[model samples]
Target chain A: MIQISVDEQACNGCGLCVKDCPMNVFEMGSGVSIPRRPENCMGCLSCHEICPAQALEHQGVVPSRRMYISSRVCSMLNRVI
Target chain B: MTKSFIEESQQNFQHDLMFRVEDVPLKCNPPAAELEQTLHGLMQMNGYIIRSLEEIAGRGANAVTFRAGKKFGHEVAKYFQKKDNVEEALRELSYILYGQYSFEPWKPADKDHYIVEENGSTFIYLVFHDCIVRQTLRRIGQEQSGPLCQTLCGYVVGAIEEITGRRAKLEIVHTGPNACLKKVILK
Candidate 1:
């Protein structure tokens, strides 16, 4: 199961996550975003990308495959990061 | 024969560049390093080409890619035996579609599909995992559900139509970074 948390202090009342999430996983309450249906989250991370406030945090989601990145770049990135 | 100075220089240059001292070995599957580099370059080039096509030709580019994907879909369906029903047909597809790109039915809460009471319509949802198209778009930071995504839409529609011998359409319900949810409607 995936767990998502919204930082109320960091939330700027932007509803981009609510509007962009394909699964209808988030809803607005008191001008803040709420994870109305966390079970439906498919872990596409669209909400995470669209959020300007970066108030959403999710855990326990499978990371997507990383084969698309070039091997050289990945090797270089691995060294530092 | 005496050692040729030119040949020695060529070998040294090739070694310094980390290239094969001799000509690249010929093989159907060249090498992982070369293949990954080619795929990465191709995806970036395709990203640019697709964006340019859309910018210049608009929907024309989509029609072109959709048709190409449809042809590929038809070709893929030819390899499998036809099934009696849609479920069975899709089950056949799901059976073979795996590896680098995989498809799985979205059965949230164990509900296989959604049924509409008003007209008794049924909609089957499929989540595409490890999609290469998504990977390609993401590599260039392009938006999802764009024209490139249409190729997959056409492919699903084509494959389903051919396998089930019915007219089918695939709709994008949501485009996420990792996976995408699509609705398959057969007529």
Candidate 2:
């Protein structure tokens, strides 16, 4: 199960989430984004990440995490920390 | 003012972005330090090859990714074929994959992996808190990337074929930014 919430106050009705959602979980309704097919939400954060207004919130286990740091970056961090 | 605004937004974003999964079963293999080291080397080599192919071929990266994954799976099967049954071999392979992913400095600390058997079928579940492929797609503003998932499917299917001598069906049961469930059914 997944939960998607859009902050009405924060949402600018940009429709980025509606367009970016791979599952088509959202729709533009009355100048706001509605989670029309919330059940189909895959928990992919594309919508959340793409939202310029930071209005969409998703709650579910994302299948994989992206944390790529090069060895050069690691060494730099080591020096800094 | 700009910094404060950014900080406030960050705070709000962090407060709202809550993810929870209940009592996920952890099926982990004991560390095989020597074997892990070897697999790590192989993966690094494969990574280099895949990247080189992608560089040369551009859009054909998916094919290279799938072929490399299949070859890697076959190699894993060949290595463990003599010592263990199909299920055990897969479990071991799962461990190696998990280890390889976790060993990366960029991987999320909370990511998890599991292998379970149900109704005479085996399931390998990998939970990625943040998938690189997803991130890449998002970065490029692409709505979907079937090839990325296809690469994984090819690997699992190839491995199953090597072990059982039968092709397995790969199904994506769930997809989320934080979690995706792929099931490999031996057929």
A1-81: candidate 1 lDDT, tens digit per residue: 778999988888788898888677889999799998888877778788778988889998777776677668878999999
Residue-level lDDT of model 1, residues B1-187, one tens digit each, is 8669998888777744456588775775776666887888888998898899889988788888788778878888878777757678787767545554576667465453552222433467787877878888988988887788888887777777778887777888888877788888776
Prediction 1 global C-alpha lDDT: 0.78
Q: Where does candidate 1 stray beyond 4 Å?
A: A78-81, B1-28, B31-34, B107-122
lDDT of 2 by residue, B85-169 (tens): 5446565556545633321111122334344557876555443344444444433334343555556666666766776676566
| Per-residue lDDT of B104 in model 2 | 14
* Model 2 / residue B164 / CA error / Å: 4.2
Q: By TM-score, who's the top model here?
A: 1
Clashing pairs in 1: none
lDDT of 1 at A69: 74
Could you tell me how far off, in angstroms, the CA of residue B92 lies in candidate 2 after the best superposition?
Answer: 7.1
Q: Give the Cα lDDT of each candidate.
A: 0.78, 0.59
